[model samples]
Target: MNAEARNARWNVLGLLPAQLIMLATLIVPVGIIVLVSFSTRGPYGGFDYVFTTAPYRQILFNEGWTGELEFNPQYLIVVARTMILAAATTFICLLLSFPVAYFISLQKATAKMLLIYLVTLPFWVSMIVRVYSWIIILGNDGVIAKTLHALGLVDNMGSLLFTDTAMLIGLVYSYIPLMILPIFASIEKLDPALVEASHDLYGSRLTTLRRVILPLCRPGMMAGSILVFVPCLGAVLEPILLGGGKTMMMGNLIQLQFGAARNWPLGAAISIVLMAAVLVFLVWRGLRAIRRERAEAAA
Candidate 1:
């Protein structure tokens, strides 16, 4: 073969490992889930090999005692709660992270490195441990309650645990570092000249931030949001631990199906649905990003 063709062949060979890994990891598992989602539940636990659409059908409808399918909004409620919590967590992280990241980015090189290390120090501990710590802090008779009692703020020590507020606190604490790191990276790479130009043009502080800094940091903000939001959707620990099993999220529902519910088909179906929704969001974001890039190029 000629040199060009030989080099092209080697390049294709170089990509084989990555292709095989994706096939083994992503594609194969998804293919199995899709297959299972279309199958029927077994007589006992597990799934039957029989082909049926009952799993997906049951997502929105339930077979009644009289053998009639009735519309059910239970799972939809869980989905809505999951989305709201994830969105709220992402927004809160973004709000809290921007100032911290900007401050870190503005520090001297040594101080910046030290601050980054401090921000990431929490990651060294296990997530379960960190979550458990929040439980202690939010639980009745925990630190907050004790402090309140000492200050005579209230007659009784109040607890915030096992509530949506507690979940938000845990989620924000756990994911804020993720948001901060990405935004810090983006801000670090920003050109100071852009801010200087904005100020020179008689821009107010807010105007400079809105017109210059924010636009530059958009990519980082997007990345951080995706990182925080996606995991928050499937967060089993925070909801279970902080919400105290009173609040049900999509992850909890999926776990129930696979474990106690013993409805693999339904679980797989839910998994597929969640996966599809996330895939749609990611694709839309990617397309929008591509369009923006193209528009910028044209301009």
Candidate 2:
């Protein structure tokens, strides 16, 4: 019908700006990055406009070709370290978020709003400031180390700053709220009657939580997890600052390639690998979520 066609056209028109913005900001930028990752740079440190597989090769074999450039297990170990750090940060954030979210969910009218506001208030600060704040707090002269020294836990302040532990702390501090928000959103939307019914069936709190609440919360859990893990995986800033700017993570290595090492090709290659890793996680999470939804429907 003409009317149907007109309505469809209008609907699409309404979506046009959003689609354009998505393309401009997300799709276009990502496409350019991917394209650049496949190409090489000129000696002047700019794109050479020459396309080649040198970058991809560099990713796999970063020995004399790149840096301490011999095919080395050390590079792989650095990548593994980044992975472990990301995984640990995600896990800890997830674990902490649930309890905080549950506490918020148990609150009443004004209290719930206040608690949520308080929880999210920290997000108002710039991420850079938030990250750098940890540097001051965890440094040798920082409060915790100084306190520990005062308590005679050690004669000197702990070398707490610029270490793996500091990196983890910064990561967790940065992302805990992200994990918390989604879980809190899910918890907020949960039906109290369902929980009541579970309790009515003589289910223990633990059993009800394990069987009912956690399953219902999977979508949010998955969402929170993806948010945390994706950014955490390719993290550079925290590791660079708190991890002492060592060969700590892929992010750090990629920075080294493009900047200090003057090897744009190698940097781009590593970026592509990290992007692929992100895509894999996203796809896996999507599949899991779809299965969860189907299972819930069947139930």
Candidate 3:
């Protein structure tokens, strides 16, 4: 056989193991979930192997006392809250990350390395540990409350731990690194000459930033936003510990179905629905990216 053909065969052989692993680990589990989502729940809270769409229907309507399907907005509210919080987390992360990334990108080599290391230092500890630290900081006798009392800002120590603000803080802290790294990589690729030219053209710093830097950084920002947003949609730990279980999100709802609710089909259905929503979003973004590339090519 020719050398090129021989090399191609070897490359395909090398990829076989990874392909099989993905099939076994990823695809098989997802296939099982999909099948389970369509099956009815057993009398005792497991798969019944009976075909039905009741689980999917249960998302929007619950069975009423008269055995009729009635419109229910409880699950819908959880879905909305999940979307809102995820969007807010993405926006906050973007805002916080861009400045840190830009600062890191502009630093001297050794300083830049140190700053990047600091940015990622939180990852060295377990996430649960990090989250627990926040619980201490936001608790009634925690740092913020104690400091406020010392400053005479409040008459007494009041807790910040069980609020939406605390949850947002935790989410942002958890995912901000994901946002920063991508934007920093993009900023590193930027040419200093471009900014210098903008300045030479009598452009104010703000004007130059808005016109030149932001456009160039768009790709990284989008990627970072996606990284933060998608995971936030399914975040469980922050909402539970930080929000004190007062707030319910899609992830928490899914956990309820599988755990206390004992409805495997419903949980599987919610999982499928969430996956479908993410898939749709990805497809939309892919199409928009393709269109932008074509337009740029034409330009």
Q: Each model's TM-score?
A: 0.95, 0.90, 0.95
lDDT of 1 at 33: 96
Each prediction's number of clashing residue pairs: 0, 4, 0
Which ranges in model 2 have alpha carbons more than 4 Å from their true place? 62-75, 150-157, 295-299
Q: Using alpha carbons, what is the TM-score of model 3?
A: 0.95
Top-scoring candidate (TM-score): 1
Ranking by lDDT: 3, 1, 2
Q: Which ten residues in a row have the lowest lDDT in candidate 2?
A: 58-67
- Candidate lDDT scores, in order, read 0.93, 0.84, 0.93
Give lDDT tens digits, candidate 3, residues 116-230.
9998899899999999899989999899998889999997855899999999999999999999999999999989899999999999999999999999999999999999999
Q: Which pairs clash (backbone N, Cα, C closer than 3 Å) in model 2? A: 63-69, 63-70, 64-69, 64-70
lDDT of 1 by residue, 1-299 (tens): 89999999999999999999999999999999999999888766688889999898899999777998899888999999999999999999999999999999989999999999999999999999999999888888788988888999966855799888999999999999999999999999899999999999999999999999999999999999999999999999998899888878999999999888989999999999999999999999999999999999999
- Per-residue lDDT tens digits of candidate 2, residues 1-299? 79999999999999999999999999898787777776777776757667888777655565575457566565568778888888899999999999999999999989999998998898899888888888888887888888878898878756788888888999998888889989999998999999999999999999999999998887788789888987887788898788788556877888888797787766777777788888887888788878977997999
Angstrom error at residue 220, model 3? 1.0
Deviating ranges (above 4 Å) for candidate 1: 1-7, 65-67
